[model samples]
Target: MFYLGIDVAKAKLDCYLLTQLEPLKGKAKVVTNTTKGLADLLIWLTKNHIPHDQLHVTLEATGVYHELAATQLHDAGVCVSIANPAQIKHFGQGLAVRTKTAGVDSQVLARYCAMIKPAAWTPPPPEARILKGFLARREAILQDLLREQNRQEKAESTVTPELIHQSINDSITFLNAQLKKLQSQIDDHIDRHPGLKNDLD
Candidate 1:
């Protein structure tokens, strides 16, 4: 059996492949948060002769960065496990591995998987996924609006340009509209999904 561990980030994935009687092998691969990246990963795995069913894959739950990949892998019939980063860090402390890099992190994950053999986590249902997407988009828009507001305030005493104020107002208005739409969609989605509605209640 092959143990695959991944250190996931927003822009790239550090992958480690561990097998018995061999030195640890790892590679840092760039992957976008999109279907193309998911397809590429599947292709790479196939080329390497890694059986999706036989491979035990583990990655840290570094927020939503790991969600898409985990969902894709699980849907493809691979055994996938997500570990809490804090737990993984504590485990690494036991091994006295202090330094942190993508490669080292990947190796640590591989070793952790080998030791703990965590059970796979099933992805949330489709409605929950949609709700999560809406929430994330709304949060992103709010963040952008906040950044623009900060910029506008910083330039208040320096420039006092009418155009800058207009731009800031326009951005805020746009973000508000987007947030409203997302909220409505999320509410409707949660209402329709009894599981999520129950969880919220």
Candidate 2:
């Protein structure tokens, strides 16, 4: 089996290949984290004679950045595993790696997969994925609300412009409405799944 370790970032993906015979043998490639990049990666792997079935891809769970690649690869019939970053970090420590970079991280991930052969990761259900997206958006809105509220409080203390105060109040009101909408949707989503509801509770 050929192990393809991908170190994902917001803009690019760094990849390294590993095999049982030569666990640390392969060149690394950097590509954008997009559909075109994923296609290019597939082409590169194909040119190198690594068939889809022989390919075992692994990457750390890097927030939502890794999701697109993971989902795309899984859809394309490639074996994919989304490993925990902490697990990968500990594995790197085991290898006595002091320096860390995208290249080095990909190498470590490749080696870890080659040695351990982690279980394949199945994509989460559509409902779960949707709920996760909602939660992330809600958190962002909440943060925005907090910042606006702080600005409002500061405006109240200082001799700020009236327009600025009005704008802040308007933003706070809009964010509050958004939060309530998100909360209702989240509650409805959780109610649809007993397991999720129980876990959340």
On lDDT, the leading prediction is: 2
Residue lDDT tens for model 1, 1-201: 667778898877777776642454544444565678878877777787888888778999987789888898889988899999998899889988999997788788888887799998899888878877787788898898899878778778576788988888888788888888888888888877768877666
Q: C-alpha displacement of 60 in model 2, angstroms? A: 2.7
Worst 10 residues of 2 by lDDT: 18-27
Q: Can you list the residue pairs that collide in candidate 1? A: none
Predict model 1's lDDT versus the native: 0.80
Query: Taking the tens digit of each residue's C-alpha lDDT, what string does model 2 give over 1-201?
Result: 888899999999999977453534787889999999999999889988999888889999997899999998998889998899999999999999989999999999888888888999999877888888888899999999999999999999999999999999999999999999999999888888757765555
TM-score between candidate 2 and the true structure:
0.80
- Model 2 regions lying over 4 Å from their true place: 84-99, 187-195
Query: How accurate locally, in lDDT, is each candidate?
Result: 0.80, 0.90
Residue-pair clashes per prediction, in order, are 0, 0
Model 1 TM = 0.74
